[model samples]
Structure formats: C-alpha cells, structure tokens
Target: MQSPQYLRNGEAPQQQQQRLPPHFHSTVSVQKLRRFNTLILVFRFASFCFCLSSSIFMFTNSRGSHFPNWKDFQAFRYVLAANAIVTLYSFAQMGISVWEILTGSTVLPETLQVWFDFGHDQIFAYMLLSANAAGTTIAWTLNGQDTCTASNAFCIQSYLSIAFGFAGFLFLGFCCLLSGFRVVCFIIYGFRFLVL
Candidate 1:
C-alpha cells in the first residue's frame, strides 16, 4: 500500500530545475552591456567638465595674481587653450561612443582600425593634459622665490593642479586601453560565433 502521508497530500513529486548562477546571468545581457558603456561615457564627460572648469579658473585667477610673472602667464594661456581643445575633442568622442552603444555596433574591422580611430583622439587628450602639467610645474617653480608671497602656497597650488591633471589623463588613457581590449575580445568572440 502507498504511504498514508503521500496519499493524504495527493500531490505529484516536485522536480527541481537547474539555473545558471547570478554572475552567469549577469554577464548574458546586451542591455546590461549598453548600460555599462553609457555609464563609462558619462564618467568621462564628467572628467572633461572638471578639466574645463579648472582650466578656466587657472587662466582667470592666474592673470590677476602677481606670482606667475609675464612669461608664466603666457604659458598658462597656452595651457588653457590646449585644455579647451581637448575638452571639445572629448565631447566629440563621447557623442560617438554613445551612438555606437545605442546602435549595438561593437564589432569593428581589424583591432588596429578601432585603435587608430580612438588612439588619435586620446593622444590629443594626453598631450593637452601633459602640457598643462608641465606648464604649471614650471610656473610654480618660477614663482617659488617670491619673498612677499605666502610660504609655499603658490608652489602647493601649482603642484596640486599638475597632480590632478596628470591623474585625470592617466585614467583617460586607461579607459582607452580598456576599450581597445574590448574591441579585440569582440573580434575573437565574433569569430567563434561564426565558427559555431
């Protein structure tokens, strides 16, 4: 005779279905990839904003300050102009990135193709940032001897500006590298998909 407990319940046996882990599920969405790309673009745009505002502040405030001398002022002007150019370039890059993500256009030709396209853009960014850092360092060193100025204040501000600018550029460069890596991976995965 069947067990009384099973008869009383009058239920069929339950079956357990297997599922992929959360991490596996997390990696399987095209929508999630688009969202991540958008987030990165937003972050880069924010960095550009910071660079623009800081460049403006440095240009305007340095003109009024007595420590930077006339030659230093000219250097700062160059730096300001470079920053503006880079900011505009960054905006253009962001626009293109956003469009690509929206259109689900991750696949590209040879990895060199994408690298050349994005590399030129990032090279300009790096040049501007490096020039800004070098100019500020020189200005600070030149102004450090002014006895009437507060102790080390000019030097500190200049150094801080250089540090922040370089850090930002480094982060931007890393992102560019990561983007190149992603392109390579896409190419490899695309080939595998075709083979399968």
Candidate 2:
C-alpha cells in the first residue's frame, strides 16, 4: 500500500545505499595497517640480528698478531658495542609498535608519537655508529704502521678495516636519511589530523 522512497528525479531508494558502513571500512583499514606495521617490525629485527652477527664476527675472527693487533681488537670491540646498542634500541621501538597494535590503540596520534620517538632514536644510533666507525678506522690506520712493519700485511688489514668501517658508516647514514623522511611524513599526517 505504501510507495517506495525515491529521489526527486525518481531514482530508487536502494540507489542511495552506501557501499560499506563506516565501521566496516575502519576495521579493514586498521587490519591492513597492523599487518604493515608487523612486517616492518620483522624486517627491523632481522636487520638488527644481521648487524650484531657481523659485528661479532669482526671482533672474534679478525684478531691476533698475525691478523690484527690489540689496538685493532679494541677498535672492533667498540664497533661491536655500537652495534649492540643500536640493536637494543631498534628492539625497543619494535616492541612499542607491537604493543600498540595488539591493544588496538594504534591511532594516528599514537603512531605519530612513535614515529617521532623512533626518528630521534634512529638519529642517535646512526650518529653513534658513524662516530664509532670513524674512530676505529683512524685507530686502525695509525696503529697499522707499528703492526704491519714493512710486511704490508698490517697495511692490508688497515685498508680492509677502513673499507669495512666506511661501508658501515655509509649504510647507517642512509638509514638515518630514510628515518628523517619518515618523520617528515608523520609530521604531515599529524598536521592533517589536527586540521581536520
């Protein structure tokens, strides 16, 4: 007995139906975001392990008078310490993100705060690593003169140490740059949230 609701142009009422409820879309978006965050955490953990292992190898195997002397060993030890510190810091960041995701509290505000924290942590870690590498290279090179003693063996080791140290420093620098970019993106998002 009752007529169907229609638009002023006579369209069917069903034509005005929304594709999805707001809650449904929000749930899906949150799930996807959580998955992404989890993946990043996994990658970061893996990287930490790799760096730690490499540092250990440099410290343990690359030693002795026939190879590197006590000074060289000391340099490698410093590098190992730096690597360990960075790994721990990264783990802490990952843990925080995981906690947020598990609690279903990973909103824009929380994520932005995490980003800011991570950026600062990353900057410090990277700078420390770079400084450690530079110091190690300088010590190894200067001490190589005494250890190598015209055999060229110490010179070769010194060059190898320099190469490895520089490579590590460059890699950390690249990571620092990437973190800076992430911080910028987070700032933009935070601004948008505040504006809206």
TM-score of every candidate relative to the true structure: 0.61, 0.53
Q: Which runs of model 2 end up more than 4 angstroms from their true locations? A: 1-25, 62-74, 106-112, 128-186, 191-196
Whole-model lDDT per candidate:
0.56, 0.55
Worst 10 residues of 2 by lDDT: 187-196
Question: Candidate 1: which stretches are off by over 4 Å?
Answer: 1-29, 63-74, 106-113, 147-164, 190-196
The number of the candidate with the highest lDDT is 1
RMSD of each: 11.9, 7.7
Query: CA lDDT of 173 in candidate 1?
Result: 68
Best by TM-score: 1
Q: Candidate 2 overall Cα lDDT vs. reference? A: 0.55
- For candidate 2, report its TM-score: 0.53
lDDT for each residue of candidate 2 in 90-152, tens digit (9 for 90 to 100): 567567657756875554465666576556556755655674666566556665465556445
Clashes of each: 0, 0
Model 1 worst lDDT run, 10 consecutive residues: 14-23
